[model samples]
Target chain A: MKSGDYLIVTLAAIMLIALYVNMWSAPQQAGDRVRIVAEGSEPIIAPLDRDHVYRIHGRLGDSVIEIHQGRIHFASSPCPGKQCIHAGWLERDGDFAACLPNGITVTVLGRNPRFDAINF
Target chain B: MMRICHGAVLALAVIGLAACGRNAGEHSYRLFVFGTLVDITTYDAQRERSDRAVQQIEAAMQQIDHDWHAWRPGPFTELNARLAAGETVTLDTVALGQIRRAAQLSATSHDLFNPAIGKLIAVWGFHNDDAPSGPPPTPPQIYALLSARPTMKDLVFGDGNTLRSTNPSLQLDFGGYTKALAIDTAIAILQRHKIHNAIVNIGGDMRTIGRHGLRHWRIGIRHPQQPGAIASIETADDECIFTSGTYERYFEYQGQTYHHLIDPRNGQPARGVLSVTVLHKDPAVAETAAKAILIAGVSQWQYLAREMGVKQVLVIDQNMQFHATAQMASRVKFEITPTPDLNISKTVP
Candidate 1:
């Protein structure tokens, strides 16, 4: 094959691969960070790109939070049921989980948040 | 051309990697316990630890429900039986503590918030899970009950956790206040475990501790006559928000519906009030005040609120008008703009 033909083939393959990733392999890149909030406290916005773990002192004691590769989840919590931890990873715009006993909640926000707040 | 192809491949890879992740925020969990929704939200980051914490909290709540359930064959039920049989019964610490607190509340509310009217509740078919087939008891039957007038004062509490009742007709029923006590106990448990921020919502009522980040906990007060929430309030730290509505429990008979909240004085459903919501730091007080104020009816509800020293309150009357205390008017942030019927003046209502 000619060099030009080779070049065209390679570029086409690369473009197809990129399209494939966007369509199927990758989850939506919409949400940028996870917002951590506890009652009567300041919000902690954690970057998805920066891999780190936070020890948050909520009303319920310590909630261990982990952020890695644009995903966030509870690593440990003071609540007895561990439901927040079991909720798995939150990686969507406006996705949220809360340990009501601990009085802390995690919500995902992109450039926009889905809800101002849930009523009732 | 080769250079261009290489550049394109590199750019493609960059785009793919850029799309690699998703987003998340505040963590929340919900459980159906105590026959109502127990919704919890937390900001804790550790997944495993959070799960453990939630499981533990749920377990404690279930235990509380089991021990104190009025219809269940548990500790509280046994205590009731012993009291009915005129036996000098020794109550566990939990039951005894509740009795002591209830004694004080009953006295303060002048027995308008009495828990010793279990038979009256049963006569209204509120004690059972099934719906009532017919109308409420006849006037003569209710009159028979009124002759007994079993007040909290009739119950004797002595040393050694022993309890005896002077009135045979008196029966203890904690339905009016058990949920509030449950919330208070759950918060205490969470606080003891070092959870500084938490909310325990049972059925529709709730108690919150600490803050939800920069803001206080926002709770919605359900409308009795309508679908969506009628009003929203920001909960103060360690505050209890309780609402009692005739809408909560009712049975239809002929063309009318009879609610479970019978006025102790009339031996019938409290009239002139549709619902009452109370916001206070003490869950026990809020629960008692909500019931007492509802029984006091519209014109007299303000007196009960003043006597209880409750600052924030909302009362809905039979006329479909809402009355809010000055403190409530200042504190509540309505989800929807107020209409004409939602009047703010207590005196006007």
Candidate 2:
């Protein structure tokens, strides 16, 4: 076989290994994005690295969410229970906090989520 | 010829990599129902078919939430009112079926999962969506309700759809049990639509069918004290994972936290355990067992789990210690570092 053919075969083998490594390697360390889903609206995805406060108008009222230092939490919410605020900060992948009455949820998203759902 | 073969090999490699695009065939829809978020995921399905299944699931779940609302002015509340007024009520077939199943489960848990303590639940101020910020009920109030000793046994089912409660205080609150029913209903809808691979997650509790493409669906049990999972489990087909935790629904009062998992035995939040997670194929059984085990506390969880036919169980005590059944220990991978002192106990035959 020609050296060009051999090189092509070698390149193909290297490419296959690279693809496998990309697919099967360890999941990235922590969540890098926050996904917010509110009723009657398209879900919003934002980078986790930026610390900011955002408000989404929900069924009950506005739910105030805060992103601080690579973490997210419900700063305040119109729902009577305030359970969303009580959920504290969500910094890890697959972690989520929801205001049921208000119909808003904040979830951390990463390359490979740790679980399909979190059972509390 | 050799060069052509190499080119073919490279072409196959590229195609295989393209096929491995993450989430290529995954479709997910989320809705707020049953007083919480319901997530429906379908893998390798046509978009139209998955959308139709999700639409039906949303409609069915909304119907259940409306028909069975415990505190709201609804059919279930009307039934409770009639039962309180010493009137025999004829229930619809669906209501009758659910009540009968809940009663049987209550018996199996030895009344630790009593749905007849609705009066106690109300007295604790948990009957509403508004989190109970307690000036907790006085002991006299709790004792007065406790003295009635209301239970599912108090409900007399007389011939076909007819029912009555002997005790006026015997109100009905399905709580987690009803959520389980909703999950099951969602699964049934997905199956009817021919969506074999899916996960139905109501709030944090979930039930999974088929798989996520190639592997079993992975689930995380939320840590009561930490941000991430306490442990992870790879679920088999038609498996339901239910957890009852102090963190789910609770309020703080006078420096103490009171959750909504009311114990019929004490007419207060079940104490001594932080959380309990149960795995089983039946959603209702898993849901009721998680509640019963949490109420059973550390000393009697195993006995209660055994009685309820729940082989996989995990309990986190007040001290942050993990107690898992042998079956559960074999299935769960603890995600915590140094794996906080897990004690494995035998699930006796």
Candidate 3:
């Protein structure tokens, strides 16, 4: 109603804005599940039957790769030249795994009937 | 007049309340140091004290880098180089002591965590940015160099820092343990400066000296293949979380891949196990666990952990399956993708 009240209201609005910005600016949540496969290891077909998709965590040399859903990607790898994590995710079904350092191979397969045996 | 008086009183009250909220215990400060610890947070009785403690720790880190860095020529470095060159160099008591301890560790680990891999790393262009633009060295090249590699036993330490190496090609590289040593040194410096509560994270190596308010330090383990992806979050009291993943270094050529973790047995990058995280009181153990897990592979890691009495470790296998020790399960909460089949059983420790 008065100049003093208006100034107080303005300051309160600014404080609220700041609080909201801080809360929203928090770090993004990582993907729900990560499937890490090593090179020469057998291809594992974990069920993607659930509506929730999964991510592939593997290495391409020293760089780590994270393939979210069906896309192949890099998370973090230790390669001296970190070019892999930047390569983005692989979308196709038969795409080669992005990780090479630990001889890791990752792939997304259709949910199979045999998914029940492998425990998390 | 009455309205003005009331406004003045309200402003004073607001300011007083704001001032009261700024009490000593409410504020927390985080310190970021690039070397030794990647990130650390500390809170002190006063902001000034916390800043002073950080400054002192930074100074100590610089000193550690100066003395222990393979690129630098400190007493130990000079002595190690001279020993490799067949020239006898006098050593100080402190240098001799450190060498002796390092030698024992090298022997105990059976050279898995060799402190003498500097030349090999340099040849691979790990130290220099202008690496040779070509395919990684062939298997034969790696093997030839590995065969001639000097054993830790070749190092001969004596009183007065005098030392010699039987192999002229021996080059000391403390990459594996130097960072841990720096963390210890910084902790000591913080204690000396009378700062009791601090968390030091050098890269992914973490050390928490004391509690934060009533809560333990919470650390998130980055997923091996996911950049900025946290696979799990764990809490520790006066412990450190040190991790090493296979993705740390490597190159790909023609669909083939090469990584930095060389298997001592075959002179090629170790296979299997995406990442290894060790939780313990000693940063060195965390460091050693990372290296050892890479060398030992996934199946052997569990046995090794049990034998070594290492309580906490998380190993993600090649199948995208996640496995954690009992201790790790207790400390870490996991989020599995595609919903892993959860199985919990105690293997003999």
Candidate 4:
């Protein structure tokens, strides 16, 4: 191939690679993020790979959510029922646990969520 | 010519990948009402139209919440008071119609889905917004209410749609029926607003109007004993999926759990079934059948399901065993690992 033609092909390949990286990086990271939505507060999206305890102040009181080894659950919540605590750990994509009385919820976000909704 | 061909292929690839991204027209609105999280998700809808539909749904829900609340001071409470006083009270058109339909359903399910057990539910301390705590109502308390046998049949309709109860103990709490009614109403509003592809999810019970773009609306059924889903299923358009689980509302009494789903025959929390899910064209029917079948327990659930004309039914028993009808078995993709014990029953003919 001529030098000019080789340069054109190389430039095209680099452009395609850059475009692919720019477009796909966000969603790949997004699939590992867990979203915590509390009423009257902005939703907090954090990485699932990192283990952390998040304190969200909801309507009733503080709800303590913990992420450990790619799974999340309500460690402690001030709601009367404690159904949130009983919900145990949520690991899979589209898995969710909500403290309804406390007005807080934790849901695993992914590039392609497996289900539109969950029925209990 | 080769360079031009390469450029064309690259352009096509970029466009195709961009198109694979999530639909731009999809919208999800979340609200907390009716004592749980309500999610309204619309696909391929204009933002303005979706907003209007959601606003209308919120307004309708507020109206229903005010009118149908059993514990609060509202129209429904007033109706209960007048009924208890033995007065032939004239009910509003909507309430009257719903009560009439509930009565028919109650008779068909043999009163398993009785709304006339409001007094019993109140005594169990489940009628309030806050969760009930500690020592459940005593045996004497339960027996006294059960002795009255306040069935929906006790409600008698008089002239001008006046309702008088033959048994004054017949208090009305439509807890099992109201959420489903609200869902049906929300779907209607969405349809009116020209939003065809949508899902109306009130808490865990929901109804879908159309597909999620190319595929059907798929959902996960929550595991009664554990976190995550026990199964996932694809829901067809205009299908109502309702699940009644003992874990929804409950009180721990001396280490024993007492849930809010009172079995009309015994006046205590229903036992032997952890959850029951039903799929039907009518949300009311689906919800009512779910509650009825759960109360019917392991031995009698199939009988009630057959009577209610519900073909797709899934029941998780207290033992953690899964029982499903043939229709449900065919569609439900069990997600539980180690392959839990699943017993698929014959189709309800």
lDDT of 3 by residue, B171-286 (tens): 87766577777788777766776667677766557677776566554555655665333444534556777787766555666777666666666666678877777778888767
Alpha-carbon lDDT of model 2: 0.88
Number of the predicted model whose lDDT against the real structure is largest = 2
lDDT of 4 at B89: 89
Superposed model 4: Cα runs more than 4 Å off: A1-26, B1-24
Candidate 3: lDDT over CA atoms? 0.58
Worst 10 residues of 4 chain A by lDDT: A22-31
Give per-residue CA lDDT, model 4, range B295-343, as digits (tens).
9999998899999989999999998889999888888888877877678
Over B270-293, each residue of candidate 2 has an lDDT whose tens digit, in order, gives 999999999999999999999999
Ranking by TM-score: 2, 4, 1, 3
Clashing pairs for model 4 are none
Model 2 residue A14 lDDT score: 80
Better of 3 and 4 by TM-score: 4
Error of 1 at B203 (Å): 0.2
Q: List residue ranges in candidate 2 displaced over 4 A.
A: A1-31, B1-24
Cα displacement (Å) at residue A72, model 1:
31
lDDT of each: 0.74, 0.88, 0.58, 0.86
Report per-candidate DockQ.
0.05, 0.51, 0.04, 0.46
